[model samples]
Target: MNNVKSLNKWANAHTYLPVDLLRMALGVFLFMKGVYFFSNIQYLVDLLTPIDKIDRIGAGMFLIHYIAPAHLIGGILIFFGLLTRWAIISQLPILICAIIINFMGQMHHQNLLLAILTLAVCIFFLIYGSGKNSADYFFKMQK
Candidate 1:
């Protein structure tokens, strides 16, 4: 009876969180795409049409060029469970911009869907702010 009770308690304490999964998924997605972006500079440069028209090509390059860092840096932060909340917060705008760009010029349903899903994951990360097992455990601010 005691063992059964303990098993039940352990299960209750270890329920899987959808949000943590979302964060990890986003991290993986970003990391993979970042590698692709860095490998093919021209491809990313073409995507900067919106920013280019506004006389911000340099700025655009700086932002887009750093997508890999988001994946690399953000992934590390999230993976190590350190400063995850801030990392997610930092990534939100980048995901939003990608979504907006995908919607702005050509109405490619696939691109739109991808952007939307990415944005949704960003939102999920914000809400969950990393789970207990994450390195976020150390820097967790008291609310």
Candidate 2:
């Protein structure tokens, strides 16, 4: 589409080293979180309990299965800046649920702050797209 091409053009023009570093850091953080969740699924269960309560269709189980893989794979894709927008879009729902669970279940300042920060960064990347330092750009240039 015209809008996507324009956005991509803008992102390519505005690439910065610090932003790439931040994006990589976010990728590592999410990957670690995914690993943590995979090892300690009970935490996810506890977090998603409120969702289960709100809906009786065993949605929590589905979410429990969905989150770890999404984070792991999405994190890697984000780190490489390959399909960055799609990766970010996949992460958006998980981050939203993370923010929502804080209030619905137990309120923890650390978690609340982290969720907000991650969500904000995800939104930024969603709008900004991947930059020149990314695999996406490298491959695009190859074309």
lDDT by residue (1-143, candidate 1, tens digit) is 67634543453355366645656666777777778878887887777565546444357657765666786677667655567667777777777877778766666688678878877776655555566556554444343
In model 1, state the lDDT of residue 139.
Answer: 47
- Highest lDDT model number: 2
Q: Look at candidate 1 and give me any clashing residue pairs.
A: 81-135, 81-136
**Overall lDDT per candidate, in order of appearance:** 0.66, 0.88
Off by more than 4 A, model 2: 52-55
In model 1, state the lDDT of residue 15. Answer: 38
Prediction 1 TM-score vs. true = 0.73
Can you give the TM-score per candidate against the true fold?
A: 0.73, 0.94
RMSD of each: 8.0, 1.3
Candidate 2 on 1-143: residue-level lDDT in tens? 79888998998888899999889988888899899899999987777776646447767678878999999988999999999999999999999988988898768889989999999999999988888899999998998
